[model samples]
Target: MTTLFDRFERAFMPNYGVPPVALARGEGTRVWDVDGAEYLDFIGGIAVTSLGHAHPALVEAVSTQVATLAHTSNLFLHEPEVKLAERLLALLEQPGKVFLANSGTEANEAALKLAIKYGKTTGRSYFVAAEMGFHGRTLGSLSLTGKPSIRDQFGPFATDVRFVPYGDADALAKAVDENCAAVFLEPTQGEAGVVPPPDGYFAAAREIATRTGALLVADEIQSAIGRTGHWFAHQADGVVPDLLTLAKGLGGGLPIGAVVGFGAAGTIFAKGDHGSTFGGNPISCAAALAVLDNVDLEHVRAVAERLRTGLEGIAHPLLNGVRGRGLWLAAVLTEDRAAQVQTAAQQAGFLVNAVQPDAIRLAPPLVVTPAEIDTFLAAFPAILTEAHHG
Candidate 1:
């Protein structure tokens, strides 16, 4: 019999493959499948649902804004967009400008252009980015991504970018030169199994960028908007980036991205330099503001700490260690059976990501509770056991 999965495979592009389960509903930090089975949603739509599923504040803001003014594009001005920019600047505590977009890739594209234009003024053409960092999937942003497997076929990419090893201060210093336009980094490497860089690495990068006169761009697409218990992940280290890109949890599951630039990078873009039709739509702006105002970040940060402790307390044999900060973390396995572990986790009524062969990344909503963490911790030992045995 031809099933729903078969139909999806036939009709859709196979980039993500056919997901095993189709969720019908979600509330708080939980979701239900078409068969009515419930799951503790630990993935949170790849860290997009910061306020959890179907958050009332987000729902109301989106609903009201859609009912009022939906989209004005970049040809017109809107209050919600202005308000969001102001709010973000308030959080950043810097003189800056915000360019809103539809997703993380779009934000990165805009940032790339801003850097290139700023470079034109400075007489620089080269760019430096960290290896193992994920910017996005669109061709422009994809070119900046350091993964060879994904970046291989999409060749003829602009040769302006040079890659350095993540968290390696000496390598970054060597790579970033006077001719470099910008240096891109991720506060925490999310797709590379939620890896955390060494302490003071960002500070070192900031100093290097300053020395080279290059714009320091921080891709906080996966770690911004309180995902790491700070408004921006770089804030934890007290470093202000020249260009900060954000998406993921910014709109609390609604699609929206932003490129926030500071100092000279802030004023580099003039009219018509970049624009997106659906970017900064009133509804998305409203939803983002609601997420910023209503999320219980204090509780979220506390639960994140507890999760770090609770996961390590399991002390499973196949488990090597856990890395990352706040709600974004990866349980590093001793073997390359992370795919099996992910499947086992799904079978066991949990949702986690095998971001790498030996790493399982966990990026639950910021609204996740202590009880929810307990549930995942309870199931993890057995899940690891199944993967190790299989």
Candidate 2:
């Protein structure tokens, strides 16, 4: 029987190709497809479902907020939006101001705009970024993204943007100069195979930014909101950047993003600089508040650590060591067979993702249990074997 999803796909863009399974409903760490086949969810909607699907707290918060007050334009103030901003500022534990948006890309776009405005005032024109860093899809964010393939099509981009080697502090120091406005980096490169920088790299970057008078921006779209067992991954390094961009799991499942600025950087945009139509709608803010309230930091940390260790125990010739901080783990395989492993795992009633040809990333919901980790570990060897010989 032809499903509604099949009909819907006929008119939608083909950018995502054809989804293998039409997900129907979800609860906690598991989901069922349209035909009602159950599977363990490891991708967690690319780390956006921090509290998992249909979490009662999120559901009730969203339902209540929508019923009470869904949206109020920036022309007026709303309680949920104000409260959510306060909550984020409190969690950051830093004196700062917030500029809310609707997605990570928009948050980065705001950050980029801030950089440009600040640069103009300071007589600086250039910006520096790192290679393999995935910022976002918008033009300004795309300019900062260091992936050649992503940038290739959008040539003649914003000028004076430099790309450097990630985790190479010396190279970064040499790259940023007096004419540079800002330096953007991911605390841990999530899309570039869950690669965490060397110890003290964040401090080194901060020093370089300070020396050059460039604003330091941390893009935590994928690694923030307890995805890596921390409110913000850079907090683990004790380095406070000039600007921080957040999204992904911020709203549990709803769409929301924010750019936080400190001191002078926070006030760069005087007025009429940037604005959004649905940036801080009460509905999204309420959803994000519920996510923050329900995502217990201690529980997330324990589960993430347990799962990280379990992934290291997968025994196979093609298996290499696992690398990541918290639940955001990537299995480094011996060969470029990450795609094969992903397919095998899917066939075995699991949903995993291959961030790169040789790296398999696991970012399950924070609610996943130890028993689920054990199940994954037990099934891992066979998944590897199936991929190796097939």
Candidate 3:
């Protein structure tokens, strides 16, 4: 028999490599393989599935909007898009303008353009970003990303960018100057094993950016949309940013991204500066609205506490400690065994991400049940033991 995975290898690009499992369907925090094996989905499509698989609210919103009006390009106005923009701004408790796109990379690309144009106005050309911080893969966003491993092959990048050590206020202060246009930082470094910045880092960034006349751009793609128990993770530090980029869980499962410009930054873009044809598709906007209305922050906080406490209680030699907040967490290992642990977990009917060689990331749905948490916790120790012994 020609399995789906076999067919996929022949037809698809090799960039993602070949996935071991082919998922056929999902509901809540559970998913089924093409062969009908069930597994608890803790990665949640790399933190994009907010309400879980096939939730009634998400399905209803997507289905209803698609049946009525799927897309209108950017040529026509739609109710869902307008309402979604307003809702996001309201959540921030700030007056801002929103530019919609289709993914996190696009959102960061848009922010990059805005920063460049703003730089022209102030006669500043250089940009500052944190080391190990990931913005996106697009050329514009890629230039701001500090990881050399990913950026090395794609050379001749924008040379005006400066890279500073993440979570170091003195380094950031030294890098940003009156000639700098913007400073990009992530409240939590998602790709770098769910690493969070040191305490008071964001506050210091804000003060430095203000003093140096640089725009503070918060890339909250992975940490926003209630993943960190807040609408935006930087809000926990009580600092307001000039620009914010968001995606991942924003559309609950649909593809959507947004760049929000606050205060004067909101008025930076003039008529016809930038646009996206499928940026604010009606279906995606409706689905995002559903996510916003249905997500219970109080519930998210409680489950996060339960999961964190359970993970910390595990007495295993391989385990070091857990980092990150809310539903976004990484189980740090004492050695480079995350890949083995991920395979062991999958074989034990659980899905996890080997975000780094020594860190396994666990980002479940916002609506993950206590029962699901208990099941994963109970099975985790055995899975770790198997990986350790192997």
Candidate 2's C-alpha lDDT?
0.90
lDDT by residue (tens digit), candidate 1, 163-273: 889999999999988999999899998888898899999999999999889999999999999888888899999999999999989989899999999987888998778
Candidates' C-alpha lDDT: 0.91, 0.90, 0.94
Error of 2 at 251 (Å): 0.5
Tens-place lDDT digits, model 2, residues 66-102: 9998877788888898898899889999989999999
By lDDT, the better pick of 2 and 3 is 3
Tell me the tens digit of each residue's lDDT in model 3 across 1-390.
888887998999998888988999999999999889999999999899999999999999999999999989999999999999999999999999999999999999999999999999999999999888899998888898889999768977874789998999999999999999999999999998999999999999999999999999999999999999998899999999999999999999899999999999989999999999999999999999999999999999999999999999999999999999899999999889999999999999999999999999999999999889999999999989988998
TM-score-superior candidate, 2 or 3:
3
Sort by TM-score, top down from the best: 3, 1, 2
Worst 10 residues of 2 by lDDT: 306-315
Where is model 2 more than 4 Å wrong at Cα? 1-9
> TM-score: which candidate is best?
3
Looking at candidate 3, what is the lDDT of residue 203? 99
